[model samples]
Target chain A: MSITIYVPADAAALALGADAVAAAITREAARRGMDIRLVRNGSRGMFWLEPLVEVATARGRMAYGPVAAGDVCGLFDADFAGGGVHPLLLGFTEDLSWLRQQRRLACRRIGVIDPRSLADYKAHGGGEGLRRSRSLAPAEIVSAVTASGLRGRGGAAFPTGIKWKTVLDTAASQKYIVCNADEGDSGTFSDRLLMEGDPFQLLEGMAIAGLAVGATQGYIYVRSEYPHAIEALNRAIEGARDWLGNGPGKFTIEVRKGAGSYVCGEETAMLESIEGRRGIVRAKPPLPAISGLFGQPTVINNVITFASVPDIFAQGADIYSGMGCNRSRGTLPFQLAGNIRFGGLVEVPFGLKLRDLLYDFGGGSRSGRPLRAVQVGGPLGAYLPESQFNTVLDYEAFAAIGAGLGHGGIVAFDDTVDMAKQARYAMKFCAIESCGKCTPCRIGSTRGVEVIDRIGAGQAGQIALLRELCDTMTHGSLCAMGSMTPYPVLSALNHFPEDFA
Target chain B: MENLPAIERTIEAIVAAKQSLPGALLPILHEIQDGLGYIPSESVPRIAKALNLSRAEVHGVITYYQHFRQIPPGRHVLRVCCAEACQAVGGEALAEHARLRLQGSDLTLEPVYCLGLCACGPALQIDETTLHARVTPQKFDALVDALEVDP
Candidate 1:
């Protein structure tokens, strides 16, 4: 009988010599004339114990953690081939607290299935929505998405269905669908994990987008920093031949790799990067819907946006919409990172207070210090003070607290952080990453750094100039880089004035 | 080529066809990068031509972006993620350390947005391998020890 061996498909595992461990296990098993079925599943999310392997027998899936090639010998002695208990054995995989408590929706299939294997995906209830979607009219699909109350997860909280509907009605035969996999936000890996661990879901979502918008082509503009995600996505595409039409107009996809610029995370910038140029934000009015990729009407959705496509159709829009507050329906996949005790990915329904995520789901600060500021959203998102932690995790809720639910990444900061410096850093970050296409972004960002520096150096008139400059950036800049760049700066300035003065 | 948006169209077509392909991103990038050598500073038009995109459309793609390198990179690429998550884990300090190390040298240190290895705390990408859990300055050095050459 073939014994089951589970090695994480996570890039870290590969880096920490997971490939070597898997190889050793196979080689050793072969040398000893044993039967071992190796399954490269996505990470179980317990990163501290990476290269964590699992063995399956008549009992449930058991864990052998932090395994390396160097530890292969000990594994054999522990009789792992025969499912022997070892020091690292954490008993049943289901009982692991990390996996049990998580209310996984976006990551439900992640770490549990081979990303590209349609059979593996289908077996695990993948594309059941797409199969259902294929039966519906394009308008029906659009309505379904709208009903789900889904919005863009790429920082801009645009409604996903509305955007699709806009694109669908935009009267362009050459419409395009672009997947923004350039997840540049800090403390966020949902996009990367989804791309790496469950690529087909994204692909399936892209296909649904194509069908909905009457588009024939799609593009996934991913960052080069995601080598594993890129590699895994490549494998996922290659492995999709079976599902791709034995027919025509069935839909097609291509992946574009970013050289490593965070600004590419911006939708327009991602478009530019895909076209073999430097990434810069574009002026909207032609709202990617009217004029997007290749001058064709484009529907550029974030990784989470595309990933949520299947869910919209799988679970009716009413059901999807019923979850969140007013317009912010359904669940959001948030990454609890940076100074958090219970850090990992959590897909929680909307309307839940930020405190639930920060304290309950996140298990408080990783530093064991009093929680200070929580930066909701990515870098551009504003830092919510402790007073506003009671706010819900919806788009409107985030906005009410002077923050954007950007990419659903909540970065925790202990009492040790310098909010003033952090604020300055946000502007400084925009200064460094801004495409320089617009004057406010190009000039304002540099000026912002200078002003913040002047303030840091105890210069007079710096704060006033900083506010004026932030206003100019917010209004004059063509894109979010300069516009939203001031969110952090302003929030920090308002909440922690002590840091500035 | 002069009109930024026209150039954007050229860039859009490079990966438009394969965008929906399951796992098609890196391959499309390899193809595009291979065809254009380094991502062209002025080839958005060429990209638009290849992919049937508009100039303004191309410009949007080019400018509102990162990761699509329009300029030639140094012989050695040193990427650092300065996102909030990384910064929280003292990535800012690590970045400063790296910047000091790369100053006045051929080593091109670029601030990448994210490499997606958040769980590893501080992560870096040298070439392709996603280097994870970089704790100390020495660890970062040794991770790139074999890669430390001309640049």
Candidate 2:
């Protein structure tokens, strides 16, 4: 019998030389005249141990990781294919504390199956949600989602059911479902992971969404940075043609690539970009639920939000809702990045404390220094001090503490970091990414850089001016781009005052 | 300049193929750029006319996106992540190294916000195909050297 070996083709794993490891393994196996069926799977989200190779054994899938091309021959000599003892052997893939600990609702199938294989996707409980949705009425489907307590996982914690309900309620001939796959946040890769790992799941979620919202066509606005994800989704779309349509209530999906504009991640700006404009932000009044995507009632959601739908339907909504705490219900895939050790995806119920995520799962800073500050959410999020590390990861909890759980991206910084510079960078990023539709964002961001520079240069009283400017940007700006820029700036000022001084 | 007719034909074909699709501008722009490396200023008029959009509108879109380069890039494009996640892990230093290394070389170095390798950064991509994570100064130099040798 041919032995099965799995190597992650996930972008993160690929970046870490998984290709080299796979190639080396193939060559070594060929030289030894051993029959091996290699499958390029998705990442397990344990990035630090990437190029994580697994071999199917009589017992289970035995793991070997942080594997390099140089270690391939050594692994072979130790009979790794037969699950023999080797220094790199990590027993079973499921046994790792990283994979074992948390609730992996959205990312359950990632790294477990061959990403390109539709048959594999189907076999592992893939199309159940769509099937369930198809059997029920549209209102019933929306109600199920509402009862699931699934909010938009893409930063804005608006209830997903309410948004779907609005689209359902709105009487429009041409409603659209736009999956906001333009995940441009610096510290996040959950969207990319979900799209690349389980393309069928996203399609199933989108199809379910189409059934509920009465949308005929769906568009996934993906960022150009994720070429692998784009390729994966396109392939999945091609393979799932019969599954997606070819009957009554036909629904179609198209993948649109975004140009390198961060502001396009904004729902209205994304709509404008899709319409082939300059990605300028549109003022809210018509609210995207009422008028969106070429002035049609649209159901725009984040990739994670849609990906969460399949599980919500497969399992009961009560099961999902029962897991989380307070207003923030269901599991959120928190991406640990930056200077943290064991940085990767941690999908847990909403009540997990910030410090637990950082120290327990992340194993603290990679620099071996004291973790000074942690930036939860994206650049627009607050730079939380060690004092606030114990803060819960709940949306309302984060919001109450003048922070946000935007996209659940936690970027850790060591003692070596300069908070003042980080604050300046937040302003600078806003300046560069802002759509220039509003004054406070476009003009204020540039002014903010100057103010930060003055402060850095030991200019007195500039701190007061900076604070005043932050207040104006916070209040006067049109969207989160300008409005939330102060989160980091003020958080840095408040938390790490010595750095600013 | 010599292949202007060929370029025009390619642009026309791309526009014709995609113009029927809803909101065809970005896809058309992507095809043009992917085919010819950069969106030629001359093709803007043709795209504008095909999509029933103004030339100014087309130009504005082409310029607004950092991906749609008006001018031709070098032999290779190296994008170094400069976002906060990467910055926390010596990405700035890596960017600096890349800048100094590619100064007079036929490689274009641009600052990308993130490449979704935040977990294993500082990350960089060469020619938008090959991504490298946990890149140090030495690794950056070695990669550049390999690129130069291969080219």
Best by TM-score: 2
Native-to-model Cα distance after best TM-score fit, residue B131 in candidate 1, in Å: 1.9
DockQ of each: 0.34, 0.93
After superposition on all CA atoms, how large is the RMSD of candidate 2? 0.9
- What are the per-residue Cα lDDT tens digits for candidate 2 across B1-151? 7999998899889999999888999999999989999998889898989889999999999989999999889988999999999999999999988898888999999999989999999999988789999999999999888888995
Compose the digit string of candidate 1's lDDT tens values, residues A1-501: 788888877775675667888999889888888878898888766666778888877877778888878888888888976668787777787788767766567678887786657799989888787788888898999988887778888778788889999899989768888998878888788887788778899988988898898987888887767778878887887777556543433777777777657777788877766655556677777788988887778999988888888877776666567676767877788888887776767887787888988888777876689888988887888888899889878888777677898888888888889998898789878877877889999888888888888898988678888899999999888878789989999999999888787
lDDT of 2 by residue, A308-340 (tens): 998888888986789888888888999999999
Error of 1 at A318 (Å): 4.0
Worst 10 residues of 2 chain A by lDDT: A242-251
Docking class of predicted structure 1 = acceptable
